[model samples]
Target: MPDNRERDRKDHYLPRGFLKGFIDPANKDLAKPLWHFDLETTAWSRESPGSIGWERGMYDYHPGTNVLEHPDEVFERFEREFPLVREYLLRRNFKGWVKQHKHFLLEFAQMMRARSPLFLQQQTAQNENTRIMTVTSVGPGNQVGVDTTVPYPPPARFIRNRTITAMREEIKKGPDWMENFHWCLRYTRSVADPFVTGTQPIVVEGRYPNSNDAPVLEDALNDHNTIIWFPLCWQACLVGAVDRFDEGTAEAPPSLISHVRGMFRRPSAGYVISPIKIESF
Candidate 1:
């Protein structure tokens, strides 16, 4: 029999079992199709021409065992933003800090990557049979409504009966699939501010753009089968309840909610740490 870790890990990967039910069927049954983008295939740069002084690649971390490995490359940009943040540690005076907080920091990075479809989509693999659904907001600004839907199907049915349970089952099948199936959904009103920042009210494209095709919000919300309802139940495991709600945010320490909004921004350059609260059935 599998222990809780094994059982929980299993639930984390497969998209058809627990995940299917975990995401509300009505939400999943929408008409919107999923959108997938290949980060390696596209050219990514800072979203703004003059946006400066912040970490360049802080938002690109992926979850799983390899989560720590990305710090070296991404941290370079972080150092550029805050030299003292890293310099103080290089002296090794904070070995105790490293010991106690290293894992927490890594987990935080994973949450950042997990929250962004830009990063999350990059981590996903192609499966013609498995339908992909994208979950993101709609409209000119972040005020846009949250919608769901299925994506254009592949040549075959690699996946069936999509759900959070099934998504978790798929992840446990192998270690490499860790970052593909899950996401952090932290939707809040204040976080929507950036999405609707400009005054002209330009027709905003979908938050996530895929290499294959850009599926707009209206298209995504229509197909529920492809949609995976944001799973709130899963958030606690990645981020503790206290830090997630109180201290982490665009303001007030910024919670995962703020990060999720940042990741969904148009031409998002960096990543934000969003709290993923997966809803339980």
Candidate 2:
């Protein structure tokens, strides 16, 4: 066998910029490692039956699940029951969402307090719940596209209609909504996939060592409603958001197609060899 000194060297095992170097070389192919998920949402699409609006007022009530609604006589007896009535009304709405998707409802309930206060008190209090609901659809298509058929609006395009519309309206009158309004999901997939490969926990050391630098990294990837399997071979895979493409800088918001193409490039594996003036034995 040829002498294995080169292979056994510390530099060989702990290559300089190992993760970054590896990904840099094989980025072309590795970038294309399937980064989308197709969500299946036919069962939990419609409004739940136990909905309690003015017309629909708690019909089919279960023991532990249902909130108690006092009768007209009872309401009149206790003049202070209006507060309870309001609480019950709001609780019913919150619990109704839980009846549909229990898992997410739990997560949303836990994070309910940490949300920012909005204009609509009743709705804003449950905005985290709304986010959980909204993200359910957006989460799937996060990296690739939130593939769905709810018929009202597609989640990927929904952001444009919802968030962008608000921003544009604010921008027309020259408001500082950009700070308040942010693109919810940027350079990250909310859904989890199992088959496809992706990167994780990537830490980039900015070129300017002492500058206020933030190196972005791939956060999540999904495929077929499962977290994609990112083969450990892929390294230093990062995600960045740019406002414009071909702007001769990295600050432009890379479009979906460009971002996808950037992730899935060829020569996505192996090493780079620089010509050195070492004398071979």
> Which candidate has the top score in TM-score?
1
TM-score of 2: 0.14
Worst 10 residues of 1 by lDDT: 194-203
lDDT of 1 at 187: 22
Q: Write the per-residue lDDT of candidate 2 for residues 1-281, one digit (tens) a residue.
A: 22222221211111112122122222324432222211221111111112101122211112223223312222232223323432342345323322343332222211111110111122222322333123333344574333343424324323322332232232233212112211111122111111112112111122332111121122211111111111112211112222322221122133432333222221233211111111110
Q: Give each model a TM-score.
A: 0.20, 0.14
lDDT of the structure predicted as candidate 1: 0.27
Q: lDDT per model, in order?
A: 0.27, 0.22
lDDT of 1 by residue, 12-83 (tens): 111122122122222345332111121234322222211211233223322221222222333243224322
* Model 1's TM-score against the true structure: 0.20
Which residue segments of model 2 deviate by more than 4 Å?
1-183, 186-257, 260-281
For candidate 2, the per-residue lDDT at 141 reads: 53
